[model samples]
Target: MDSSSPDETAPAADQTDRLILEVARTELGLGANGGADGDLVVLDDATGALTRAALDALEGTQHRVVVQETSVQHALALAEEHRGALGEGRLLIAGLEDAPADLATLLAGRSVHLALARLPKALAALEVRASSLARAGVPALIAGGRVKHMTRSQNEVLAEVYDEVHATRGLGKSRALVARTARDDLRELPPRSSEVEIAVRGMRTAVTLSGIGSVFGGASADAGSLLLLDALDQAISAGEIEDTTRSDGADGESDGAPEEARAATPGEGSPAVLSARSVIDLGSGNGLLAAYLRSALPAARLLATDDDLDAVASTRATLESLAADAATSDGAVGTEESVGVDAGGRPGEARVLWEASLAGQAADSADLVLLNPPFHDGAAIDATLVQGLLDAVARVLRPGGQLWFVHNSHLRYRHELESRIGSVQQRARDRRFTVLQATRS
Candidate 1:
């Protein structure tokens, strides 16, 4: 984290980023003379463009700049790519319970004078970000976004955390929201909750889901995920998929075929039991899919991973809540041991991880992977992310492992899945969403 001279040809800020920088500079009284006495924090700049430009603009100034990004992938990129420009102890992975002592110390005591942020689309996300800065005693914030993406709700969300909130005039299709006078008694947004019915051991069971503002779709169950779950239930009941939990095997391949007898044990109407030993819920937003898997496949070891720290926390909360609900249900749906870590400190049946695209996942490791990938990157639609996600999931899946994927119907990801992963089968499709089951080659 040592500071060096910024790269001469770093990515420049776009219109929105530039406007944010401009507003921040004006609000902080950082004029051409470059004499300011406080630190700065930049939020959610995925490209590192805003951060780099800020560093260059603040060069030789009294103020220090630290960037806080929710995505581990983005944070690592900023640290590695902009190593020359970013100073040591200048980057913080926000929303972590155990942040580094030095970073916490640096940010403590209302030291951050201002924050420049790319306003998140979700009001909850914006509120969470704003409340943190306000709680830390940052006096002002300059948040910008494309004019088309900006909404009145953003102003309202910020107003709740600050004494004053106003919008800037549009600048080349970009605009900013300036909020000042951080409130002393700012309240943190509570995690939202919703319930969705998922097939658990051949029975329709309602599972509670929880998420903070940053989590995608909040606590509501995504339609695509629901479709995927239905497909999984059908596949398992038809003996198309089975729990091939091998106790001793290095390769992730199922040697045995259709277990005709096990399907009969569940009876005529009930869904077949899935004893999959290892399951990965990639991008486990709000833990909806992971919670479903936890109940549906109790014996399976569950691993949930997400890029956003908030989403990871949301997943943990959702699963933990599930375990708590189970404990008092009097032997209804799931057991107390289904979701969290055991008393011995070892992870129980389910584990939630904050990582970038299966960062340290081993090849051919998981028996089954569930994914409901987001097509949009922030406010803009981005189809490229799907291919990258598919590639990552392919590497971790063992030979003959299954990837149960769901996506918007318009995205038409079947060809991509067929080419990158192995054979692809359309498990379910409606007017809006498509569910595909791809087998690892």
Candidate 2:
């Protein structure tokens, strides 16, 4: 074992460390290394009390000495280098926190007699690693400074893999557990899943998963779960998913018309107003607006951003399908040879789809933005997301850019938008929805 002077800069010693020391000294009856030389190693010098107590217990035993330094890289290298030197003597590796994977694997391969590790979080990865070592017939001991109420199934996994599993009384609000994996009775256990029911706006919804998937009324389901679902249904029923097209002679431009003339000419059946550039569709469930933008703004640049990765992927699929349809239509119309980009310098036909966190998107970068920002994460209404949306608008829009968004009248987002982006005006309003427009100063 390697011994070094304790560093004074370690975190202030707490009652928990003192308790660990008293328990090891009294329960294990360890003394200084004056006689009975044995193999002993001190692992983490940062926690001097545990190291001292462990060293006191193994003093004067007929064991060779090996020391593991605290640096993760160094400790791993040392373990690999001295694996052959361990012979038949027991190895004790103790620390306030568990070692990293490479070091743990190297130490386990050595003729390790005992392995002691402590960690802050009881990670699932650690549990899996411990199970593998226990299966290899290695005697491993894992202890923590605090106790945590692990799932009953996880506890069973530990009990099945280790010879002994012990948990101590709560230390303040934290708890700790110790597991010894030295016996042959260890058995692997089967994994299980559970279901949870959430009540959102008086509607019962069921979700199935291993852990509680109903927290905050299925916020994990994305956005304001039930509200977003209802909004999406409304958007679909409102014919928001229809594909709009413009006619060949709609614009008075002949085959070789100038770019400005093509811009001024209205496609035969297309909407008079071209879709705005630099668009953002928040709460864009399934990306209907993004798909609409692709066709509506065939000449204008388009950006369809959402917070849901699934929605983004779905929108991408829809846009790709639209592109294929456009390609087929081009042959019939005698339009340009290609479908996406034209010789007239029109914007690319493909839509740019992206995922963004409303609370975290960049500002002052868009010419036009659309939003159906959520009012809550779950059952509880969070006005903070409204502020986040306003902030995102301020960050992602250029000066004088327009922001068109839909929301319930009850939200009263006018004041919030006015405060962040300068003026807010209600362009349209109804019982179930209000369409508001704001412009950057």
Q: Give per-model CA RMSD.
A: 6.6, 14.7
Candidate-wise lDDT, in order: 0.71, 0.44
**Per-model TM against the reference:** 0.78, 0.37
Model 2 per-residue lDDT tens digits across residues 80-154 = 333433333333332212322223343443444443334323344345445545765555443445444344444
Off by over 4 Å in 1: 1-4, 31-36, 46-49, 53-64, 84-87, 93-110, 235-275, 328-347, 376-384, 409-415
